[model samples]
Structures are given as structure tokens and as C-alpha cells.
Target: MLNLLSNLICTALLSAPVVSEPANPKALPFEVSAYVTSENKIRVAVEKSAPESVVVLLRNSKNEILFQEMISKKELKYAAKLDMKNLTDGAYELEFKSAQGAIRKQVNVATKPVAEPARVILMNTPAE
Candidate 1:
């Protein structure tokens, strides 16, 4: 009886389910950088570990798409330029899409009122 009970206890312990922790999701292996030039153009740079074709889109605050473009190349570096001069002065979004996924970053383009040029004055002075 003692041996049978020990065997039963050992079997119960061995048959117990093992608890495991969940695994975290993998992150995207790419980096996105954006810049606004002095000429009111938005330039987005896409850098990735592998070569891929990227699709870029610009949208307004209301989620309406303003411009879209696709770039295909063998290299990992690419740039997308968007003209913001025609767009209204407000907040905007630049979205980068590729085989991995899509990433968005906010961009603000504000325009100041144009100022008129001032008159130039030329004075002639005699050297002592």
C-alpha cells in the first residue's frame, strides 16, 4: 500500500501542467526621421535593416490624405519630399509604410505673413 501511494504521488506530480510566461511581441527593425526644409518642404528619411519599397503618405488633422508616393530601391536609405506651401497652415501627419508596417509622426507647418522690404540708405563719408 505504501509503495502504491508513493507511485501515485510521483505520477500526479509528473503529470501536472507547467505554467509558462507569455512572450513579448517583436518590434520593428527600422527607424524614421523627418525634417522640414526652409522652403516649406517636408522630407522623410526611411532607414531599415533590409532593402524594401516604402510608401509615404501625408494627411491632414481630419485624416484626409493630401499626398502619396511610393519608392522602390535596392538600398536601405530613401527619402520622400512633400510640398507644404500649398497646404493650409496647421498640424499634419507623415506616414511611412513598408512590408513591415506603417509608422506615423506629427508635423506642424506654420507660415508667417510676408513682410515688405525696407529701403536701403547709402551715405558717402570722406576718410580723414
Candidate 2:
């Protein structure tokens, strides 16, 4: 019975699906990616190297910083969102700075405000 169980385990391990890595791996210690997660809000993802803190900076085409923030990193995979309301639509850059290095990505802000769904609530009053 023990031998049979060992063989079954080995077969299962051999049959398991394997996940392939990227053909071209990133040479940078860390990677930062940005996308429009919501209307007027761009979501940024930080992955790869571990970091303590990161500086989030929004810059215009002229390389002038329009907004900035220092965020503390708690986990290896960290995410941040930037509000793009009341800003003109055009090319922009989102820069994330850390001890390892900084990564910048170009993003265009043309997202419209997301429509919020309606909500209803019922209230009950007690006798005075």
C-alpha cells in the first residue's frame, strides 16, 4: 500500500501543470505599471524588489511635477491610485521612486467620471 501511494504521488507531481516564465525577464530590480482602474483614477502597481517607501509623482509633458505623494510600502506587491480630476487631457508621466531605483510610465488622462449606482435605505423609529 505504501509503495502504491508513493507511485501515485509521483505521478500526480509529474502530471501537474507548469507555469512558464516570461520569455524576456525584466532587468530592473523593480517594476511599476499603471492603468486606468476607474474614471479619473489611475491605478499603479509596484512589484519585484522589496521596498520600504516610494514617492509617487505626476508630471506633465514638460517634466514638471503636478502632484506628488510619499507612500509607505507594506508588502512586496503594492498598489496606488492617483486622482486625475480637473486635469486637462494629454500625455503625462507617473513616476515611482524607491531606494532600488525609479520607474516611470507614460499615461494619457482622458477617462470620464464613473457613474455611481443608486442606493436606498429603510429606517425604523422606536416609540418615544
1-128 in candidate 1: lDDT tens per residue?
Answer: 54333322221001111112112113444566776655556667777776677777888889998888776757577777765666666777777766666676777656554445699999999999
lDDT of each residue in 4-69, candidate 2, tens digit only: 333222210012111122322353445666666324466777775654677778888888999887
Point out the worst 10-residue segment of candidate 1 by lDDT. Answer: 11-20
Off by over 4 Å in 2: 1-27, 73-75, 110-128
Clashes per candidate, residues 3 or more apart or on different chains? 0, 0
CA shift of 116, model 1, Å: 5.1
What TM-score goes with each of the models?
Answer: 0.59, 0.52
* Candidate 1 pairs with clashing backbones: none
Off by over 4 Å in 1: 1-26, 73-75, 115-128
Error of model 2, residue 80, in angstroms: 2.1
Winner by lDDT? 1
What lDDT score belongs to each candidate, Candidate 1 first?
0.61, 0.59
